[model samples]
Target: MDVSKVRKDFHILEKRVRGKPIIYFDSACMALKPKQVIDAVNSYYNDFTACHGRSVHYFSAQTTEKYIEAHRKVERFIGAKENEVVFTKNCTEAINLVANGLKWEKGDRVITTKMEHNSNLIPWMKLAKERGVVHDYVEVDNEGKLDIEDLNAKLETKTKLVSLVYTSNVTGATLNASEVAKICHDAGAMLLLDGAQAVPHMKVDVKKTGVDFLAFSGHKMLGPSGTGALYGRLDLLKGMNQFIVGGETVKNTMLSSWEAEDSPAKFEAGLQDYAGMLGFGAAADYLMRLGMEEVHSYEKKLARKLYDGLKAIPQVTNIYGPSNPEERSALASFTLKGMNPQEVALILDESANIFVRSGMHCCHLYHQDVIHEMHGTIRPSLYIYNTDEELDKFFDALRNIAALA
Candidate 1:
């Protein structure tokens, strides 16, 4: 991939913040949207300002056509059919849909990993509380590497689903999707992947992997916020009940009985974010044009440099996850020997205009239980728009920050 050209697409990279250009290293939290996504969102408000479907007005027709195409585009982007993809408010909601929608009995069990974001972790816990279902975990090491043998041991006849992150947002460690899928399937359990961190940074083909469901957010992939998707196997989706019920979710209703719409429509309730959906499609298109394999390779090369630089800093105490960049996404979470993570983050921003994430990174279990760092670690995450020069500046700024340590 042309990294320079990719940086050009993100106009925010061109603008200065507080008298200095931004070296954004927080793509894991939310990716910087490109101009193409921005323009697509703008076109919705500027051109078509009408609701989709059940209307024959010109703008309404335009909205309907665009909405359908958006669905198809995202479906193609994820290697799923148009009918198999359901749009939700975010990945959290998408995960909740599967958690609640799937037919569950009192004794049923759900499995997830210790390294999950709260989005993937909580729903199963709630199910265990409210529905008398069993919720279990596939343990990970201190460095956030999942134990595959423990996963195989956890499966049982009662296990209904195995939900796990395809890639760790905090540590950047990746779960083996295909192997996990086979293990879960062999044990008669459906595998659900929290792909919020994986789908954006790498290629995730659902059919080839045989994962039953995947949930990911558009905002993490340069699409608009408040837009996310759940890709489910068609038969499985057809079997699920609607997670939410509202106007667009039903086909017809009666005083005594109601008929629900098909798979996606049945699951999507109320008015949808038509503009955000279009912008999401556009973002997928942008990534497709750039190529995901190329994106992965570029991030790997940059991450290796980042890993080496951080390792060279004498004040740096820990680098979370594996040392090999190719084994994980382009992210690093580390702690300074004598400095708080928040203090390090503040220094990086004030001194060099760098943006990084600090705190538990939404994985308190990993921090409090595994790494034993309650203050959390400073994380510098990268994307296609990030450059080697940015890494050089990051190292320079970090070295200066280390003097205080």
Candidate 2:
């Protein structure tokens, strides 16, 4: 998709550290901003410089109009209706909003996987603690793939929901959403997907996937931080109770009581992130222009090179997730023999000016259960801005480091 030309859109790519140009492989944790998104964020402060909703001045009017338009932009990007989207602080908040919106009973059950990020795992754990709700975790195999047959056996009539990761941040594994959705529906349970990792790199349609709810962070998808969204079914949202409520969430209020607004507004309580939403919409538009199919194809090619390249190194050991590029995202986690992950990451940056992530990648349960290492593995995740030349540099640097080990 003309990635060489696309690289110019990111000004940070030009920065040099020590003597070498920055080779960013940390897109999984947070993607770098493009100039287009940066400009959109600046437009609010530069052009409007006012609050959204309840204000009728020129700047306020412009802000409200653009703010609503941002929702439409994000909605269209995910194939959702006008008001089906709820803005939040991050994917953690988005998942929490969904988790709290539902009615929890003593025996109500939620089935999730062991490989989930803390954002997905912790909320359900909280539910189990506060309420008498039962949360069951489906196990992953040695390769980090969830056992589908085991998941099917676990589903029951009492299971209220099934939450799963669309793609693992540490393992680089992408689950079969359609298959998971079908089992939950057959068991009379709803499905929620943690889409923080998948939404940025691939095409995801809420209606097509049949998932009732999807949570994702804007920062992971080239948008500003403190911006995220929840895409929920209209029927489900209407039935579900709003978790957070405050300013502009209601039509009327009295000392006696207050009636909340419907759907999105009811879910969104306080003043929103106006500039971040504009940037988030801009990020979605940028990806739309690039076309997700092209992004997916390019990443698959990159993943193959990343997986195979890591495997060829003599001292490299224990690559996480599936070796098949088709079964995973454009990220890999591996530990060097006799070397710690943090030291490995530090050496790469110091010696080669490479930026990579180390540590559990926020999946502690996965580490305790599957890979069996709390120290985690060196991870280099790719995005559209990454180039083949950069990967070659990474591989050469890694080979040198492995020789030292």
Residue ranges of candidate 1 with Cα displaced over 4 Å: none
Residue 210's lDDT in candidate 1: 88
lDDT by residue (1-405, candidate 2, tens digit) is 999888999999999889668999999898999999999999999999788887899999999999899899999989998899988889999999988999888999999988899999999999999998899988778888889889889998899999999899988888878888888899899999999999999999998889999999999999998889999999988988879888978989999889989878898888888999999999999999999999999999899888888888978898888966678778999999988999999999999889999998898888877778878889999999997788899999998888887
lDDT of 1: 0.90
What are the clashing pairs of model 1? none
**What TM-score, over all chains together, does every model reach?**
0.98, 0.98
Q: What lDDT score belongs to each candidate, Candidate 1 first?
A: 0.90, 0.90
Q: Across residues 74-172, which tens digit of lDDT does each residue of candidate 1 receive?
A: 888888976999999889999999998999999999998878898998899999999999999888876688898888898999999999988998888
Clashes of 1: 0
Scored against the true structure, residue 174 in model 1 reaches a CA lDDT of 91
**Candidate 1, which ten residues in sequence have the lowest lDDT sum?**
321-330
